[model samples]
Structure formats: structure tokens, C-alpha cells
Target: MRERIVVTGAAGFIGSNLCKMLLQEGYSVVAIDNLLAGTLENLPEGVDFKKVDVCDSDFSRYVEGAIAVFHLAARNCLDDCAKNPVDTARINVMGTANVLQACVEYKVPHVIYSDTSAEYEGINMFPSKIDSVKPMSIYACSKRSGALMAEGFKNYYGLNISTVRYFNVYGPAQDWRRVIPPVMSAFTIKLLQGESPFIYGTGEKRRDFIHVDDINRFHLMLIREKLIQGGTYNLGSGEDYSILEIFEKIESEICSGIKPIFKPELSGEAFRTLADISETCKTGWTPQVTLEAGIKSFVAYTRERLRLG
Candidate 1:
């Protein structure tokens, strides 16, 4: 039998993509999601998909006989998390604890926790290193709570866990239906429809955007090599671009001739984010996708999706 891998939030953007990658690599994927923010359409075929919430008491049964578990389920929208902090905590914190407990009980060999660079919100430093983190928003704080739970499992239960902090990941199947969507998806979708995209704040905030494919490359490496056990890593392009810069790049590809509409900035977000990937690079995984190429391909994908709809 092929090695089995369990993925939480397996219908969401990154989870869905990761499931596809694991399936391609000959692993039997058991996907779990509640469809709260994820859609059934996003899930790929051949997965033993269960419409289950992470916090469900019976969630442990899915972890049985799995070699690894990727805990990606979380309430991650900044605005939504800010407004519904209680719900966010219930999902990101309590839910994560439940998942870790299941992993511990089942003696899963390895566990991968999906973290975010938003942990650097209160810091002013460039090229954010993994050691220092000061999360300011509800979303970040809840995720930090989850990370702490994972740490506890690693320390007390000896659960081998690796935490990966991602910075502005984007690609096809990116969530475009959120109350406040990611900039890349929002801009691409609006431009494809000949409408003006909204730019929250001054459009000057700098962000480190890494393609989803590059992220999955690093993920596959971690699973296959098990290079750094119980380590925290940053996955990013190690480069920062302003919001306007990203808009220009996307507009250049689409030639939409539509300018963005300025709006008040969203609260509880960092002004800038850049990843320090030196340690991650030592693991022999470097980002393979270029921003230019990634954006161009993403534009084409968005156009095709719009055309189909």
C-alpha cells in the first residue's frame, strides 16, 4: 500500500494544491475539510475526502495509519478574523490543538504546520528571520497559538513537527471570494472583467510574493528528505515589491487599461514583509518561480477561468 498522508483544509487553495502534488508523488491522500471557506469544486479527484471540521471530536479517526499530516486548516482572513475573533480562536487555536492531539495519539511520524509571515506584523525589520515574531492581528495571534500548541506536542509528546511560514503565496485556485480577497486574485479577476480593482490604503505597502508552485516544491523536499526536523522555516522569494509594483506587473500582462480605486487600508496588517530564506536554502530548496513568469501565467489562468464562467 502507498504511504498515506492526511491533510486538513484540503479543499482550500494551498491544501488542494498540496493534495494534487502528494497524489502525483504516489501517496494516498486523505483530505478533510468543513467547506466553511473551502468549496467542494476545489478538491481534486482520488482523495479520500471527508467533510469534517478540524475541531470535531471524531477527527482523530482520519489520522489513523497516516505517515504524515499537514495541518493547514485555519480561519485566516485578516478582516474576518478581526471581526470574529472568537470564531477565529475556536478554529485556529482549539482546532489546531485537536489536530495535534490526534497526531500524538496516532503516532504519526511527521507533521507539517502551515504558518504565515504575518507573525512579523509588529516588527520593523527587513528580511524577516524565523526566530523573532511579534504577531499583532487576531489571525496572526491565533496562528501563533496554533504554533505554540505544535511546539508543546513536539516537546512533550515528541511529535516531529516542522512549521513553514509562508509570505503572500499566489497562483491558480487562489481564493477570490473572500470578504476581502488577496490582492493578486482580486486584481486579476477585476481586470479580466474590465472592472477597476480596489487597492486598500496607499498601494505602497511592500510584500514578498512567492508562487504556490515554489511553495509546494519546498514542501515536497521537506517530506522526502526530512532534512530539518522540528524546525521553523520561511518560504518566500526573499524579495519585496510594493502594491503598486504588483499592480503594474499584472496590468502589463492583461493590458486592461483599468486603474485601481484607492480605499482605506485594512486594519491589522503589516506595512511590509520580506522573508529571510538563508536557513531554508541550506536545506537545498530554492524558490524556482520568477515573479514575472509567475504573474504572466497567473494572468492567463485567470483569463481562462473567467472565460469558462
Candidate 2:
């Protein structure tokens, strides 16, 4: 029998991609999602899917006989989280605890947690190191709460766990339908439609964007090689690009004449984000896609989806 891997947010953007890779590697994937923020269309074929929320008391049954449980389900919309901190806490904090409890109860050998770079929002250090976090937003706090809970499980139950803090991940099947979609997706979608996209702030905010393929590569490494256990690693490009620069890069390819409508800056967001991926790099992994190449692929995918040339 092949490895049975359970992914909590199997219908989500990154989660869907991870599931596809796992299937390609011949693993039997048991995917779970409540469909609140994920769609069934995103899941690959041959998956044992259950429309389940991670917060359920008996969610652990899905993890039975699994090699590892990849916990990717959470309320991740930053602005929405800011407006409804309680809802955010309920899903991201308590929900995470429920998943961890399930892992412990099931005696799963390994757990690969999908953490966020949002935890570093209040810290100004460039190329953010995985130390001394200062989360500014409610969403950031929720993610931190999950990490803390994971630590508790590690200490008490001796469960093997590894955390990957992602930095602005993007690629095909990106969530372009959110009220505030990722900048790259929003830009490509709007430009392909010949509409002016909105820029929330001055478009000067710098962000470290990593291609989802690059992230999946490391995910494969973690699962197959078991390179680093019980450690946290940053999944990023180790390079930063300003919002305006990213806009220019996308616009130059999709629709040259479109201009973005500028608006007041969003609250509870960091002005800049750059990941210090030195630890992850030590394992002989590096980002493989260049920004231009990545953007070109994004534009092509968006155009095809919208039936545009």
C-alpha cells in the first residue's frame, strides 16, 4: 500500500497544488476542506475528499493510518481577520488545536505545518529571520497562536513536526476571486480583462514573493528526504520586489496601457516583507524561477482561464 497522506485544506490554492504533487508521487491523498474558502474544482482526481472542518471534535478520524498530516486549513484573509478577530481566532487558533489533537491521538509520525510570514509583520528586519516574532494583525496573531499550540504538542506528546513559513507564494490556480486577492493574481486577472486594477496603498510596499512550484519542490524534499525534522524553515525567494515594480512587470506583458487605481493603504499590513531563507538553503535548495519567468507564466495562465489571447 502507498503512503496515505492527509491534507486538511485540500481544496485551497497551495493545498490543491500540494495534493497534485502528492498524487504524482503515487501517494494516496485523503483531502479535507469545509469549502468555506476552497473549491472542489481545485482538487486533483483520485483523492478521498471529505467536506470537513478542521475544528470538528472528531476530525482525527481522517488522519487514521496516515504517514503525515499537512495542516493547511485556516482563515487566512488578513483584512477579513482584522474585521472579525473572533471568527479568525475560532478557525485559525482553536481549529489548529483541534488538528494538533487529532495528530496526537492518531499517533501520526510526522506533521508538516503551513505557517505564515505574517508573524513577522511588526519586525523591520529585512530578510526576516525565524526569531523574535512580533505579529501586528489579528490574522498574524492567530497564526502565531497555532505555532504556539504546535509547540505544546511537540513538547507533551513528542510528535514530530516541521513548520514552513511561506513568503507571498504565487503561481497557477492562485486565488483570484478573493475580495483582496494576491497582488500578482489580481493584476493578471484585471489586465487580462482590460480593466484597471486597484492598488491599496502607494504601491511602494516591498514583498518577498516565492513561486508555488518552488515551495512544492521543498515540500517534496521534506516528505521524501525527511531532510529537516522538528525545525522551522522559511520558503521564499530571498529576493524582494516593490508593489509598483511587480505591477510594471505584469502590466508590461498582459496589458500595457492599463493603470491601477490607487487607494488608501490597508491597515494591519506590514510595509515590507523579505524572508531570510538561509536555514532552508543550507539543505541545498534554492528558488528556481526568476520573477520575469514566473510573471510570464502567471499571465499565460490567467489569459487562458479568461479566454483572452
Candidate with best lDDT: 1
lDDT tens digits by residue: candidate 2, 198-303: 9988999999999999998988888776657788999989999999999999998875698999989988778999999999999888999989999999888888
Minimal lDDT window, size 10, model 2: 220-229
Q: Score candidate 1 by lDDT.
A: 0.93
**Sequence-dependent TM-score of model 2:** 0.97
Instruction: Return the TM-score for each candidate structure.
Output: 0.99, 0.97
Alpha-carbon deviation at 162 in model 2, angstroms: 0.3
Tens-place lDDT digits, model 1, residues 223-304 = 8886576799999999999999999999999998999999998777799999999999999889989999999999999898
How high is the CA lDDT of each candidate model? 0.93, 0.90
> Which pairs of residues collide in candidate 1?
none
